[model samples]
Target: MTAGLLPAPEDRSADQGVRVSRSHHAARKVEVTSPKGTRTWSASALTDHGLPSAARRAYEGAAEAMAATDPSCQLPWTLLAGVGRVESDHGRYGGSVLGENGVSHPLIIGVALNGAGPVAAIRDTDNGRLDRDTVWDRAVGPMQFIPSTWAGAARDGDGDGVESPNDIDDAALAAAAYLCSGSGSVLSESAMSAAIYRYNASDEYVALVMAMEEGYRTGVFIMPVSVTAEPSPDRAGNKGRPGRGHQNDGRKPGSGATSSTKPHGTPGGKPNQDDPSGPPPSGGGGNDDGGTPTPEPKPPKKPPKKPPAPATEKKVGTLAPCGATWCLDGWTLDLGGEATLAKAAAHDYNHNEVAGETNQQELDGLSGAKVSVVVSFGTATVLEIEGLPYP
Candidate 1:
């Protein structure tokens, strides 16, 4: 749904009104922008809390690496932990465990995304190499990365000489990088919501993840004296600091997968079983460490202002292919670049009839046909088709 459309029904465990309570000591509030308005987030000091030994190390290591490479991102370990908890319970989903080497013991895989039911239909991109399904794709590992996305964002977090999505170290780093993409930093509330939305493409999912993340930040736990210490000389020297010098762990896992169907690392349909209705036990919901005392997060710098957008314009284009859920929901026009037909226009088209057929039916049949579009803010509510079955 766009800005003004009725909100999609909340998913299991993802109430549209979900909010993380902030009673815990040392909590800090950060405003987050969502489709439902502004929501406050409480972030707190670093704590080992309830995280597993290997998993905690990987989370911290990934944050530290990102800090070194992209300091502006201010990527938090807690954020990565939130995704892990929601996606696969920190590699413990389905009785699987994060082994000493940081790889999932039994491997956590989701159902095939065959475009069946509420699931998005995505043709197999990896040919049974990563998800073990040649016909369709499935979310895999603690972070649940899809094969195509993993191919681009995969990292060697543990410096183990191989990059596998099943490894928490690699998965966590890849997820951090994925969330940190685009122009703005994730520290801002709007940017944070945008980043998470890019991950799952659902407002409910964003609220749920933020709530769980806030839980970890404020929950009672042993606070580390220093959460942002400079990388230790030993750690800085070895890219495998978290791996404990284990280069060849002998774990050669397949490429990872995602539960959802959107391309470019969007995992839409994966069920978050960590806490169906609430936050997990403290640190379990989030994990990342800082060696120095955790300092207060600085406010994000505002971007330079821009002029207001123009009212409207007309362009010629063909319809974009209906591959993902977003495409199926609205009309996508390919006028050199993909643009969506406004929801209001879509509703009108669906109701009108053309040659005894509903406009939606006709529009679907006319996919890829040339047409002229009247657009504003990259969305159009008016169209002039070159060819139509009816006048």
Candidate 2:
């Protein structure tokens, strides 16, 4: 197994029957996705006490991307979704969203970050490029990333070349990656606490996020009942599409995430740091663990000039936005012929251990195989093996 940044333990708060801070108000049109396709439902029919549909889609999308991009992080999609809810309400904290392509408009910037409150005092690290502040830096985006934190971990999940903190696609992916920085499973109670602490450092914040996640698992937070409806990019994504095709998104290996300040809990095995998340860390609260280093995100290299669907080692569809983790998504693997891997589970799967070319050997005789156990870092413990065709 790839060394975990920190083995995250299962959140104990799951047993708490935790509740979310936000009460659900039925939105007129709530979008949903499933085997049949995309659809929408009435907000008044019933409501889940959690994030809105769009926000939930972003979180689920990030979870899918991270299964390949940051396998070390074992936290479920709900955890990241909860963070987005508490941080900036999934980039809509103040009526902001992906207006064009996948960029969050009306930009989501935090306060001046003066350290007067529970937040730590963090000076400007990006020279006003990200936060637009020449002095104190603030957390930006739906997931609430400070400039420095975004620099190192930021990923262009939309393959837009630019790693904008405001984009929920990139921001959620980066946030999930940041949490996987330590060397333990985040499932254990200890590791779970540590992981949440890394994100915020506040016990209360952890509890709140934990509660929200529990609600999501139960019917408290629900996926819009799969129904027939119009797809709305206005909600979670462009009908489940990741990004706006291939843009030069100028990222480089070890770029994006600028410095080495750990965004979450320190690499140390401690507990209850009392750091509040959101905005910038004032040296105490928020992403101030300054823990260990995670695998640096590699920028997308221009693909070799070739025919469309470049075949051998070429990125296509959902795999295009993924940078260094492209191989993990089975993009380069020759699934014999015209086909791609479809995720068995829509919301639950490991993002890190995605199938790669190396594993192609296992599927060599798949033509005659009735059943096969093909696994790459999705969920390690649960092996939902079955014969699946490459899309």
Candidate 3:
């Protein structure tokens, strides 16, 4: 496993119920090899599968490439689909669309790896090249490869000549290579767990990915019904996805406490010092030291209030001329026009956040390009606009 490639776990507690869901799936196995040992799959399998078309293709292509190059690895496309589903929901996360070329538009960049809460801190390695932030490195693309790891393991799976983390084909291939770097076939449950654990050192993440992989391998993949669905009692506090942070109060998966500042509690162990959970601590809080004391059950505490919504948000989409000023949907940029947009911050064609008058002059030409703009107080301002045909 690479040092800085440990991305934050994602929030997928809602889908934990698949373990006990309806088991009848017609028992169909996805084909992965032909008589010649080359990878192959039916078009109906790809079309009817839950994964998006581009993402499925990328996963299968990566598996095929790995099968030909490293025959001993035995990489399956379903494992990649499981990772992609948990990582970025097959590149449909945050309303981002996966292009025909396996590139996710607006880019599925994970939260900053600034060591905040349960997240691992990784200082800027690519200088805001892959992820837009220079202060901290983030997981990029459908497979969510960190900048440093992507720099080392990037591969041009789509034959695009350029190796980009934003491209799902490259990211999936890179992920397959990383998984196969170690010995053992990932088709086996134990080997698959070990391989996934290397990807993100969390047991819950491995379990979730395995569950998803099993479902995909069979035809009974049960996705989350809704975002509001709660985690099962067994998975309770261990709510997280593949390549992002936990949705719990900044807690790592399987940990009993809200924060990792203190000792983490295990099953039947002492409660954490930060947030005491499970049973009462030893002899205190109703469990008397002596006698069969009749301890009254305490009422459940009220759930914590959710944080207020942010006043401003970054809106990502295509931008076009709305009368005089540039607009995306109903929102219009406060800039006078392409000429007045010079002062706003922007990123060059390579997605690198640039500065100075030279970069500012290039902003005038982005009339109909895809962009990310900060919308606040009913006024939209360009933050980091993608330049030209998109990298």
Clashes of each: 14, 58, 6
TM-score for each model: 0.47, 0.45, 0.49
Query: The CA-based lDDT of model 3 is what?
Result: 0.53
Tens digits of per-residue lDDT for model 1, 1-391: 0111111112212222333222233332222222212222222312222456677678889889777766667878877776675566567665576798888889866666665434556678889788899997777678877776566556778887788888899899888866765333576655665667666554444544554465455552221111112233444455333422111111122111111122222223222111111111222323366334444444533322221223443333344455431121134433222223212122323234434543444456656554434444334333333322111
* Tens digit of per-residue lDDT, candidate 3, span 247-286: 2311223322111112111001111112222343233344
Ranking by lDDT: 3, 1, 2
Clashing pairs in 3: 8-244, 9-244, 9-245, 10-240, 10-241, 10-244
Measured with C-alpha atoms, the lDDT of residue 359 in candidate 2 is 24
lDDT (0-100) at residue 366 of candidate 2?
A: 30
Top-TM-score structure, candidate number: 3
| Candidate 2 ranges beyond 4 A from true positions | 1-53, 69-72, 97-102, 221-391
RMSD per prediction, one decimal?
20.5, 22.4, 18.8
